[model samples]
Target: MCGILLHHAGDDDLYHLKEQFLEFPEGSLSSKRCSDGSPIFNSIIPYISARGPNYSSLRVSKKYKTAWYSSVLSLRQPFTCQSIEIEERYVLQFNGELYNHEIVHNDTQYIVGLLKESAPSIPAIIKKLNGEFAYSIYDIQNGTFYFGRDTVGKRSLSYFLDENTGEFYLASVTGSQPNFIDCTAGIIYQYSTRSKKLNSDLSISSPYEIATTMDQQLTKLPNCIDGLFEHLNKAVHRRIVSIHPAHIENSPISILFSGGLDCSVIAALICKQLSNIKKEKKPILELLNVGFENPRTGMLPKDVPDRKLALSSSEILKNLYPDVTIKLVNIDVSYEEYLEYRPKVIDLMFPKQTEMDLSIAISFFFAAKGSGYTISKDGIKEKYQRKGIVLFSGLGADELYGGYHKFANKSPDDLAIELTRQINNIYDRNLNRDDKVIANNGVEVRYPFLDEEVIKFSTMEIPINYKVNKMILRKIASEKLNLATISDEPKRAIQFGAKSAKMTKDGNKHGTDILTS
Candidate 1:
């Protein structure tokens, strides 16, 4: 994940606001360092360097001052590829990834290339591509700028226009907290860039409104289970293989595991995909199980549901998959640690959705910090690859499938409606909050369940009953993958599994209040 900043000062002097743009929130500017270990503030363009520590590039015209910054974790290196100059008339600044990187390195390159060749409409060009991206293309010749994000809203992009100064500013994060972030001026405005015209409201759907698409033909299709499995497997494969240093045979892929059905199924699929890719060079899997210290007991394993469940599943996978090595990363956070990280988590989440802050923050904080170590041949040292830690999260299963307990007793019609609503509203539910929290450590979170194809099939093509309680998913795991032990495990919410929900009981309970103001 990289940071892209654009400041178009219509009348305000750009130099006067240098300190605000050049510094990161929470006084982290001092910690921002380049590849050479020098402070980012020392760079020629400090604001660009501050946002993107690994690499920074800038383009300035009389009307606009743009900065494209990329950290070491940049998926396709937008700093180099997308920052191309064409006749010194057009420039691109991009942040995020394109799944079709083999053909086009970044969104800007693809969009600009299309413009150069045929100059098609922006929406038409976006429809032809698949990936999560936020990019800005400047036409110096026209003195106009075009900036947008992916259709699915997988990446965070926000813009604030100071009507007083006639300056329009766009950033990965618009504000850190209430009454903070002078750029946003209190009102939160996010980029709702989409391919298909979908409503972009950040509202949670009611339980009855969330349901799978009521399609009768799904059950009639031959090899239905295999088809669904293939789609999910492909989703996992895409994310796993996309990691930089592409072929790090020994690198471990991390999974936020609760030993429940959803995560366990993902674990099995990853192992299967890795085995198919290379029988000899099997990838190590890290199951990160976070268990918080109980306030009542002040103990480590204080009856945390995830602890026992994760332990059992880890053992089962270790015994079942010979080629795959399973590493259980146990993250036990003390109450003090939780308290210290809570405010930071809230601030890091742009707009600071306070209602679900504790639960989401707690889960992601531990998940982001969890790491797997590779021991040296002599067994004297361990190594941590900060960039290569790819996180696999079972996020969309609850929305796509009827994994939520609330949906258990819903009628078929209600379930169908509920699934459709949840699927449509999934991006805003917790995706942005989850992304910001996880990306804090530069580790990218990939959700195979949220794959565009998988989502379409699960929500539109598949029947609603198949998703209720994830019955069909369990069947595939037990029958095809031989994971009956985990397939039978009940669904447990991440907050409950990690003891976060219980701890934050008295804290803000109204999520709507956070977004409204």
Candidate 2:
């Protein structure tokens, strides 16, 4: 949820650093000191101070002859000097939530305890975690730093490592630099179920479209439902742990609730957690439901009424948690408005532009960020610093649990394999958009359904019938959370229900877009 900048010896001088810092004043840098222990000089670019927000920090180390700078708007936890470790050969700063911290911490302690040893590879240690993240660890020992995005690339981590000068630069967004390479517009291929093959028609710059193919090998039969539920529960619990109670209590945390099964499940889980904690005053939980001002004629299906889905969702949420506040934002703007913002959204979501077709999915996140809610803890304000804010999203529910109608006709084994393909597609399509848009807004987003624990459980041997039309998920929700019967309700895409302003060739459609300059 914050910004970190690192620079090694390159073409830039002290003045260049000052100018760069001035551009992002909300950023800070490492510094150098004299032998007398007095503050010697600033290491961050000066442009950061003049134009960016007034929140920046600096640290200097004579031992390593290195400095670090940060312009942090903390969402997860407050930034403390003690949390940052500056050694003789390393400078490390991270902006992410370590979901398996408890396990990792325990394992680290156990290993260190047994061998009586200390390890300098924090990144290597961090790779053991099971959640979304992007971070860089500077190793002065090797004169090289290591930066990586999560396995799914949920949290964006982009770097500019100049092979010519051996200098490294990292940022959450591409526009952070004037000379950033235009890596967009590349041919991005994806495994298409509809075509039953890998296709290279998609682009990193385009919107994400949902496409599927029928698998004839799987049978349509009832399967084990309890196992899937067990996995989902574990996933929810892990995501909840990522939400530092201290952070939520200090600042507002917003949830994007479409009233769909995925979001609804998350909402119920959060409410349950809050009640279990027994905190007299709960953190401000803002339920955001975006709807179209006029969906009857302009965009929606002829049979569907305006705001029908949102209304149903809102009603259920109100009945479930009357104490929680719900806020609705109507994006009544025309398609023109959507088109106007398309470019900026595309750039933010697909900085590398390996494909142009992914822009559609990216636009949705831009619209959400424009509403001023950070989807993750890192997206929160500095004054409200804590571990991190956890934004719950229902990302992989539809694909894994067979929420889509496409699964109705397929056999159990075929459905499972099909679902696996869809889940894998997440990385190339929605996952990147979701992670980048939130990270660009300096927020973190957590997907309980996409949790590793849930994935492992759902993929195990089970009856395929239980997954048909999200049968397993609905049963769990109804029994465990006392949620309304979801089996009877039809599955609806959020973009369609929200009456998104984008237009397609088919009609005023949810995922339609016209190529533009």
Candidate 3:
């Protein structure tokens, strides 16, 4: 949600080459001119100002000869605390949330407080954190830097290291860096003396025990439908109540709803949770569905099921939860608009994989860009004044619950093994792409299905037949939750469902040239 820049000034003339290292391209989104009309990228090494408008702070460490800069996008808490400093010997630049901080302490503290409790053993500290985060801490005493992220890799971290000059650049945003290397989650990088070398040590796995507990609970229950429904409900409740008390009031929650089973389930849960909260003014629910149209026909592409299901689902949700204000914001995108923003999307995305992945990123780009509300009656002209700061995504549900058609007709043994593999490796498959696209719009995305507890139950405890293409999920929603509208909604890939791929192909054929030069 925010931007952070960290650099190590180790006996090099960084000031002379600052422009070469910090030049912002013409179309980059993160780097911008400050209030004083000076670009933040031109700031002094290790002393760059914060990146976003939410909160900005700078800290200088004479002891370690380092400077830390953080632009905080307030997620669950405010910006009362500064950089993470332990005994004035270590300072951390952090960029994510700590979901389990409440149980650790009942104070207005952040991961810094939790970190102090688990100090002296970095691996132990990493294991204790049950949230999405990416951070770099400098050890003033040892003259070394440590970097880490969560197991799900929900936060992006990249670094540029020049061994010959002992120069280092690390940041949470990877705009257009030339030779930056991606940091893997669940591993702590311990940068030794600048001239020596860099090494890494594996961190501990997620401390999720919901799988064993869910199995035991299901044994006691009469049927599997009740068991899955109960566990999912608890998962949704935890995510909503986990936000800091200060952030809950007047902070609307946005759901990337396509009217499919995954998103419909999330929307229903949020509606139920919000209706029960004891607040004077209830928070509004914004359901965003991106609609793609044919450039020639000026209508939604044929075979796009999202439009029909999304409209019906919105109507049902509104009638079901009248107390909570539910607004359906439909973003109708044309091929011309798709081509116009295609390069910006691709450039911002960095295109790490194949064209198929890039198409998915394009679909997500429009979805994220369409997060805000509309001021005009047309509803296509988005206003920057978005009421929702926190967006919820049903990302992990597909991988965990076998929502893909490929998982159909598989034997019990094969299904379980494949499900386990997909759940474990999901961080690499889709988290980074989705995380970057969503964060580019200055919104923080929370995944209820990816919560440690939800992951454990859906992947390990759910029975094989129930897990086939989310059969158990549909049954519970239809029979128990009474969500028949979305119970049997077929899964549609975002790119195809939103017609993003078709738009790109049509634009290219008509000589529109979607990629920016």
Q: Which model, 1 or 2, shows the larger TM-score?
A: 1
Sort by lDDT, best first: what order? 3, 1, 2
Best by lDDT: 3
Off by over 4 Å in 1: 15-53, 58-60, 63-72, 75-87, 101-120, 175-222, 244-247, 279-282, 296-302, 371-387, 504-517
lDDT of each: 0.60, 0.49, 0.65
The ten-residue window of minimal lDDT in model 3 covers 17-26
For each candidate in turn, the TM-score is 0.78, 0.68, 0.82
Stretches > 4 Å off in candidate 3: 15-52, 58-67, 101-108, 115-119, 206-224, 296-298, 301-304, 351-353, 371-385, 505-517
Model 1 scores a TM of 0.78
Candidate 2, 1-517: lDDT as tens digits:
3445544434323222221212123333322211112111232233222212334555544333334555444433333321144444445555445566454332212212322226644433544655655554554555555555444455544444445544344444443244433211122322221222333343322222222332234342223345565666666666655555566565555566666777777777776655455455754555544443332345532123324554566557657775554433222334555567556566555443422343334434533443522223354322212222346677888877788777789866677678767775666556655555554544557777766666655655544556678866777677766676533566876655555434444443333343445
Poorest stretch of ten by lDDT in candidate 2: 32-41
lDDT per residue as tens, model 1, 1-517: 4665566655545433232222223234432332221122123223233334443443344334433333324444343433555666666566665566454344445556776764455445545555555665566655555565554456555555544544555555543522223221111123222211122232111222333445455554346577788889888777755554343474677888888888998999888877666635666888877888756434464368898898788888888787887776667777788778777677667565654565666677676787434334365435443233567888878888888889999988888777777765555666656666676665667778877778767765667767779977888788778888888888877777777654544444453445322
Query: Scored by Cα lDDT, where does model 1 land?
Result: 0.60
Ordering by TM-score: 3, 1, 2
Q: How many backbone clashes does candidate 3 have?
A: 0
- Residue 165, model 3: Cα distance from true site in angstroms: 3.3
